[model samples]
Target: MSVSEQFVGGDGVISTPIATGVGTGEKAEVIGHRTADAKPSGEYASILADTPLQADEAGVASRGMYSPLTSLCNEPRFATMRRGHKVMVGQNGWLERPGSIAKKPEQPKKAGFFDSLKRIAKEVADATEMKSSRRVKGGERGRASSRVRISLDPREQSLLYCELEFLLTSALDCYINSQFNAGRLDADKYKKVVDAWHQKGRPKVVGFRYDLETQLDLVFLHMKDFRFYGDRASVPAAISGILEAMRVNARALRVRTFCQPDSVMAKQLLDSQSLLNLLGSAEQRQIQLAEVVQFFKIVLEREHKLQRTEEVRGLPQ
Candidate 1:
């Protein structure tokens, strides 16, 4: 027969029964009642050593009769030792069991070499197209600027036309005189004819000081008309025709006899021809007629040194 002892377990509500007087190598049967459950239950029993039991500061007895394996399972470290469980150090050195940390999002894929090359090519093409467009616009602006129009009043135009007609007639008369009277080129007669030609349709003045400005005005007035009418090309053609006519007349009169190198008449004729050639060349080169006239005035002042008493004999006259 065996004697049964009843005592409260570590938890205050559960009562455990321990049987004594069991034979050696035989296990004692212990029955336990769990207050958490609705029924009294018993598990497979193991023989435990008779260890002394003590109470902690909380007035609860220490579990001395429990198996070492059971005590280890109840430890804080091994409590969360199952699969996929995590343990971390919480605030104040406490152990914490939290859920899994979220994974970082994957990085985006890199661009390929061919894609980079294509992007560079497109950028270059765009830059070139922009440059070409700008160049075309600049060219158009240059063309527009080049076609500048000049304006003139009717009175000025008439004066310019009359001057040109006078110059043409004087050139023809000089050429005719050179042809007809090759042996006797009368300088006085030539001067008289030119003075008479200029006096036509104007008030007769006994003596007037015709300065450089007056001479340039009288000679270059026709240039203004040509520029105003946008007929600059005709200037060269007119000069060429006059030069051709003079050459023909010179040929008929025998060049050596008509243009004596040492004579004042020959020098005047040559100077007139040179002045016309210079004007034609200047026109072809797009030089401003005002600048040409200024230069011509300077040359005339330096060479002729015309005084207040002398009349201004214009280039062709």
Candidate 2:
């Protein structure tokens, strides 16, 4: 029978098994010696060869034949390995330990001054374009050339004119009371009167209405003392202002009546126009208290006539 055993050499080489046999009826002989000139082949080359080991102490101590299985610690690729420390495989296939690899520092990206300005300019341009587009659309809708003529009958036109005149009178009275008598007009009633006049169809009356309302607001603000001032200038100024507004209203009414030549309101419109013209001429020559009184008297008489007509016709006041 032959016995053989395999072993790995100290230089990290694997050796083949060597076999020895005993002849029949003969004692087994030990063959521990081989010729010095012998060179090994195949798996037993490093084990049986007579080559001398290299005289490198560090190389001989570091090399292991069964490093993957028998070695308890792995050699580090970049740093010294300490006892009881955990080892890890790095991204580059190197053995790494704790705190061995340094992290790359991060840098922030900086923007140039011109680049910031360009971004702000672009935002402003976008906003301006949007605003311009909105303005164009608004202009197209509200252009005066797009206005159409509105038609109304004689009675309806007269009623609308009378209502506007009444609203203007009420606003003036309210202003006078507040400024002279320290009276407070009922805000709700004032707003209702203005709103009612606004609901009527009188496109031409809008300008004078706004003028009256603006003057009343100035009076409420106590912009001037109309009762007495230098040479009674404030009173004349106030009268002239009211007379100018009335003239404007009367002119708009005349135009409306002229459009409908057959309307019965034409007669009333003519009379009102003549009175407004007279007042305007008087105001141009420096308004007097007598002329102001006469103006009020004429307005009161027209209002009284309208009330009488409405009552005679069984119409609501």
Model 2, position 86, has a per-residue lDDT of: 46
Report the lDDT tens digits of candidate 2 across residue range 53-84: 22122222444322111121122321233476
* Candidate 2 Cα errors over 4 Å, as ranges: 1-148, 183-223, 226-247, 250-317
Model 1 stretches with alpha carbons more than 4 Å out? 1-146, 183-317
TM-score of each: 0.18, 0.19
> Which residue pairs does candidate 1 place in steric collision?
none
lDDT of 1 by residue, 1-317 (tens): 11112123333332122223332323333442222212222221221123221111111122222222334334543343346644456543246435633465799897664344334334433433332232223356655532221111243223322332233333333322222122122223323433543566433211111222232232332332222112333566654444454444334333223222112222223333343343332221112222222222232232223321243544320
- Could you give the C-alpha RMSD of every candidate to the true structure, in order shown? 63.1, 55.0
Residue 263 CA displacement from its true place in model 1, Å: 36
Q: What's the lDDT for all of these models?
A: 0.30, 0.34
